[model samples]
Target chain A: MILQVAKSFILESIRNTGVFLGNLLPAFIFIICSWICTISIKSSPETLDFMIKGQFFPISIMLLVFAFAFSSATIYLADLKANNTIHLLKRTNISPAKYFLGIGLGVFLMMNFVLLLLLAGYSFIISLSISALISIILICNFVLLAIYPLCFIVAGIVKNGKVAQSLLVPIMLVFMFSITMTSLFLTINEQQPQDYYIYLIWNPMLYLSDTLQFQLNLNDHTWLPLYQYSIILTILCMVLSIFAKQIYIRQD
Target chain B: MLILDKVQKSYQNHSVLNGISSTFQYGHCYLLLGDNGAGKSTLLKCIAGDEKVDHGSIRGNEHEDVSNLVALQYQFFESYSFLKVKEVIQLFTKLIANPSNIKDLYELLDIAQYEKTLIKNTSGGQRKALSLYLAFLMSKPIVLLDEPFADLDLKKKKQLFGFLQNQVHLQNKCLIIISHEIKGLESLFDFVYIMQDGQFIEHGTTEELVEKYKNPTFSGLEAVYFEVTGQLLGGRIK
Candidate 1:
C-alpha cells in the first residue's frame, strides 16, 4: 500500500496537467528568468562570480520554498477529499504518520529534482562555480528537510485541500518575495551587503546567503553551521508531526 | 462481526446517538431505515471512524482488522475535480490493499467507457455509480451504503439492489444499507432497523414484522415506517 501510495503520487503528479504545471513550471520560469536577467546584465566573469556569491542564497531559498509548499498544497488535500483518498487511507493499517512521511519523501525528491534541473540550467547559462552551486544545494536541502514536517502538520489540521492552498499561498509568497528582494539588494549593492544582512539575518534565507559567502571566499567562515540548522529543523518538524498525529487520531 | 456498545455521540448540547448499542453479525444484510437527521449517517460515520463517538466502544474480531471491517459510501455530493475514473478506482483499491482490475470495476458499475473520463464531467447518476463501485471495491466484509438508491433511475436502482443482494448472499459479507428506498430491498434484508428520536424504535425481519402485524393494509415496509414514525412517506419526512 505504501509503495502504491508513492507510485500513485508519482503517476498522478505526472498525469495532472495542473499539478504538473504547478510543480515544475514555476521552477522552470524561475531558472529562465534568472538566466535572462544574467544575460541582460552583460556581466564579466569576475562580476558573475560576485553575483553568484551574493545571490545564490536568496535564489536557492526562494526555489526551495516554492517547490516544497507547492507540492504540499497541491497533492495532500486533493488526494484526500476530492477522491475520498484520505478516508480510504484511514481504513488501512498504514499509520497517518507513516503515510505523511512517505508523502514528505515524495515531495522532497520532486523538489530536489527541480533543484537539479535549476542547477543544470545555471551551469549552462552562467559560468559554473563549484563552490556556489554546492553551497546553494546544501542550503536548499536544509530548508526542504526543515519545512517538510510542517507540511504534514498543515495538512493534518486543514479541513481540505482548498483550505490548505489558501493558508499556504500568503506564507509562500511573502518568503519568496522577501528572499528575492533581499538577494537582489545584496547582490547589486555589493560594496557592503552585510549591513542590510541584519534585516534577514535570523531568516532561513540568510543562512543560505552566508553559506554562499563562505563558499566564495573559503576564508570568511562566519555562517551558522549547517548541522545545527538541520538538527533544529528536524526536531521541530518531528514535534509538529507528533502534534498532527495526535490531532488525526483524536479527530475520529 | 462488528459491535458498538453503549455508543453515545453528541455535538455541543445536542445529542445525535444516545447509548445506541447493536451488534452486526457477519453474513447478513441489515437495512437501517430512518427519516432525515435521524442519525443514520452519523451512525455509519461513527462506525467508519470518520466521527468519534463521545462515549462507547466499537469492537471487532482481532482477525478482522479495522480496514476490513467496513466500506462506507456517503451521499454523493457531486464535488470533485476532473479526476479520471480509473485513477479514482486505482487509488481506492490501493488504499484498501485490495487488488481490483479497473476494467472489471468499471464494467460492474456500467462505467467502462468512463475509464479516462473525468468525474466532474460525469452526470449525477454516473457519479453515483462510480461512488458505489468504489465502495463495492473496498471488498470489506461489512459494506455500509448511505442513500445508495437516491437519485438513481428505476432501472439502475434495480441493478444496484440486485448487485448488493448478490454480494450479501454469495460473498457472506454483512451489508448494512441505510436508505428510505427500502420497498424493494426490505424483503431481502435479514433485519430491518427503524430509527426515530435518536433510537432504534422498531427492529425485526420483514417476514417477522409482516406476521407480527398481521395486516395486508400495511402493504410494505414503507407502511410500517409511517405507522411507527407517524410521518407520511411522501411528505416532509424529517
Candidate 2:
C-alpha cells in the first residue's frame, strides 16, 4: 500500500500536467537564468569564483524553496484533506506512516531530480574540479534536506489546496527573503566585525550557506565550524521531518 | 455485522450523535432516512470512524478492522482534482488490492467517456458515479452511503441502486445508506431507521415498519415521515 501510494504520486505527477510543469520549469529556468547571468562574468576564473560564492549559492537556495513548495502545492491540489483520497485511504487501511512515507518519497524524488539538473548544468557551464562539483552537490542536497520538510509540514497544515495555492507564492517569497537575509547578514558580519556573529548562529540557513561557502573555498575560514554545523543542521532537519510526518498523519 | 454502544459526537456544544446504539448485520440493507441537519451524516461518519466519538465504542465483526470492513461514501466527497478519472480508478484498485479486473466498474458506471478527463472538470453527477464506483471497488463487508442518491439523475440513480443491490445480494455486505429519498430501494431494505434530532426516532424491518406506519393511500417510504414524524421531507426535498 505504501508503495502504491508512492507510485500513485508519480502517476499523479504525470497525469497532472500542471504539477510536472510547475516542478520541471523552475529547475530548468533557474539553471538557464543563472547561466545567462554568469556568462558575461566568466572572463576570469576569479570572476566566476566571486559570482558563485556571492550569488549562486543563495540563488540555488531560493530556487530550492520554490521547487519544494511548488511540488507540495501541486500535491495538495488534490485536496486530500477535504477530498475523497484521505477518506479512501482511511477505508483502505493504509496506515498514516505508509501514506506519508509515500508522499515524502515523492517530494524527495522531484526535489532531488531538480538538484541533479542544477548539478549537471553547473558542471557543464563552469570549469570545476571533480571535487568541487561533488562538494556543491552535497551542499545543495543538504540545503534541500534542511528546507523541504518545512514545505511538507506547511502544506499539510494548510486547510485545503486552494488555500495552499493562494499562499505558496507568498510562502516561497518569505522563504527566499528569510534565507537571503541570513546569507546577507553573515556576509555583512564577516566584512565588518565579530560583534553579531554569535547571534546569527540561530539561523539554520546560516549553517547551510556557511558550509556551502566553506565547500566552494569561497570563505578562507568558515565563521562557524563547518563539520559541527553540518551535523547539527542535519540532525535538526531529521527531527523536523519526523515531526512533520507525525502532524501529517493526524491531519489525514 | 457491526455494533455501536452509546456513540456520542458533538460540534462544540450542540450534539450531533446522542447515544446512537444499534446493531447491523450482514446480508441486510439499512436505510437511515432523515431531514437536512438531522445528524444523519455525522452518525454515519462516526460509524465509519471518520470522526471520533466523544464516548462510545464501535465493534465490527470479530477479527475485523472496522475501517477496513466498511467503506463510507460521504455525501459531498471531493475527488482528486489533479487525477484523471481512469488514474483514480486504477489507484483505488491498488489501495484495496482488488484482484478483480477493472472492467466491471467501467461497465456499471459507463464512465469511459470521462476516463481521461480530469476529475475537476467532471460534472456533479459524474463525480458521484465515480465515488460510488470507487466504493464498489473496495468490496468491503460494510458499505456506508451518505446521500449517495444526491446529484444523480434518475437513470443514473437506477443504475447505481442496481449495482448496489447486486453488491448486497452477491457479497452479503452490510449496506447502510443515509438519503432523503428511499423510493426505489424501499422494497429491498431489510431494516429502516428514521433519524430525527440526533437519534433514531423509529426503526424496524421493512414489513414491520410498513405495517405500523405505512399510509393506506401511499405506497412508498416517502409517506413514512408524514405518518410517523408529521413533517414534509424537511422543506422541499429534491
The DockQ values of the predictions, listed in order, are 0.34, 0.51
lDDT by residue for model 2 (A147-192), tens:
6566567667777677777777775666555656655675667653
**For each model in turn, which proportion of the native inter-chain contacts is also found?**
0.27, 0.59
Those runs of model 2 whose alpha carbons end farther than 4 Å from true positions after fitting are A1-4, A11-53, A69-78, A120-125, A146-148, A162-179, A189-204, A221-230, A248-252, B62-65, B98-102, B151-156, B234-238
Model 1 spans > 4 angstroms off: A14-36, A39-57, A69-75, A78-84, A130-135, A173-206, A212-219, A225-233, B61-68, B77-83, B98-106, B151-155, B211-218, B232-238
CA error at residue B238 for candidate 1, angstroms: 11
Expressed as tens digits, the lDDT of each residue in B37-154 for candidate 2 is: 7888888777777787899888876736576577777565476676788878777777675533536656757789889888778887678777777666776778888777787678
Best by lDDT: 2
| Tens digits of per-residue lDDT for model 1, A1-252 | 566556555555555667667656655665666666677767576665555534542455465556554445444644465445567566655676666666666676666776777778767765557767776777677766656656655666666777777777676666555655755675567745555656764355455545655655732664456677566556655676577667656654
Report how far residue A142 has shifted in candidate 1, in Å.
3.3
TM-scores, all candidates, are: 0.82, 0.85
Q: Tens digit of lDDT per residue, candidate 1, span B100-198?
A: 344544655677767777776787767877777777776778888877787777776777777777778888888888877766666568888888767
User: Candidate 1: DockQ?
Assistant: 0.34
